[model samples]
Target chain A: EAGVAQSPRYKIIEKRQSVAFWCNPISGHATLYWYQQILGQGPKLLIQFQNNGVVDDSQLPKDRFSAERLKGVDSTLKIQPAKLEDSAVYLCASSYGPDRGTDTQYFGPGTRLTVL
Target chain B: AQRVTQPEKLLSVFKGAPVELKCNYSYSGSPELFWYVQYSRQRLQLLLRHISRESIKGFTADLNKGETSFHLKKPFAQEEDSAMYYCALSRSNYQLIWGAGTKLIIKP
Candidate 1:
């Protein structure tokens, strides 16, 4: 079976620029999540979506970062006016559903972003 | 708030030696724990979960709720065992709260 897929495996941008990352989740999965992993740190969730509806986004920087799961299958995370501190790996993952909360989450090869 | 910790930044052991990666968590409720691994050039993937209580690739982790720890252990480490390991905790059965991962290097 195909795993989660992400575009532009690596990205480079300047501070204050805008950057976007895309994600295509596993087929039939109903839960999608976006996480940011800084160097030497674990992945921290930025947002979560269940069938196009946001489930959580408490950690997201609302002033600059935004994410959307359009049509409930693909997702895009965007950071406007990016900062040097925003340099990190953007990981996308999918799960069967919220009811299967602890079910394994399939992850995509993350997009490594560097802000100069 | 839920938090996970992996105290070691790096761990090195000779091939065929025993390996143990430490993990600790802080949560008020019954927590579900998981170990995720990332091999070079590979995406992070689930290695095991505490609820399953199963071993994979000869690595096993036992959750000690009393100590608030879930340490990954392998009796005989192999070169292939070298990778980045993360310990995560899910509070209230929701999305995971992850630890800063440990880099494992098994030298031959």
Candidate 2:
């Protein structure tokens, strides 16, 4: 129904600054994902959470990027000391369960971050 | 590692013409494939998945395991079909791998 929800549809920060994004998954969704989509490129998975426990974070930049899905419903992605290269659209998606891997992933409008 | 590829960056066709959006994937295991679409100013949404063997919005894709391809096609294209399409592949435990995506423009 309501689909995933994201806050601050757009954000701008200077290089070396910090930024954070918020996302709320659909009700009853047990799996949530964060992805980065640069212009002209496909969305790349950053992290995945299965009810507050991380299922995957292989691509996340531990040095400066981190994400947490506390309480298993809402998630927040933070980037400390943002780099110009970090400028991209941050997308959040959620699914009912892991068993439904082929099921549709409801996506939010995404947070467009611009690092100057 | 699994990979998805959308060879064409852009495809243009006139209204009422046949349309095809090619998608090729490489994976070690029996892969699951999906097609996602994003219209202007809209969030990306799933178009269809190969496992279901179904069609949506007049678009259908047939999985060819031998060819390692899952090309989306429609008998006739409409102007409203214009959008960005991405092909994705998922393995056993990993997340979906996506292609660069193709922008389909249906000319009026």
Per-candidate TM-scores read 0.97, 0.97
Top DockQ: which candidate number? Answer: 1
lDDT of 1 by residue, B8-27 (tens): 99999999999999999999
lDDT of each: 0.94, 0.93
How much TM-score does chain B earn in each model?
Answer: 0.97, 0.97
Question: After superposing the true interface residues, what Cα RMSD does each candidate give?
Answer: 0.9, 1.5
For candidate 1, the per-residue lDDT at B66 reads 93
lDDT score of residue A45 within candidate 2: 94
Candidate 1 Cα misplacement greater than 4 A, ranges: A100-102
Model 2 Cα displacement at B42 (Å)? 0.6
Candidate 1, residue B72: CA error in Å? 0.5
* Clashing pairs counted in every model: 0, 0
Q: For residue A102, what is the lDDT in candidate 1?
A: 43
Candidate 2 C-alpha lDDT tens digits along A3-115: 89999899988999999999999999988999999999999999989899999999999999999989999999999989999999999999876665534688999999999
- Model 2 C-alpha lDDT per residue in residues B1-108, reported as the tens digit of each score: 578999999999999999999999999889889999999999999999988899899999999999999999999999999999999997666478999999999999
Considering the two chains of model 1, state its CAPRI-style docking category.
high
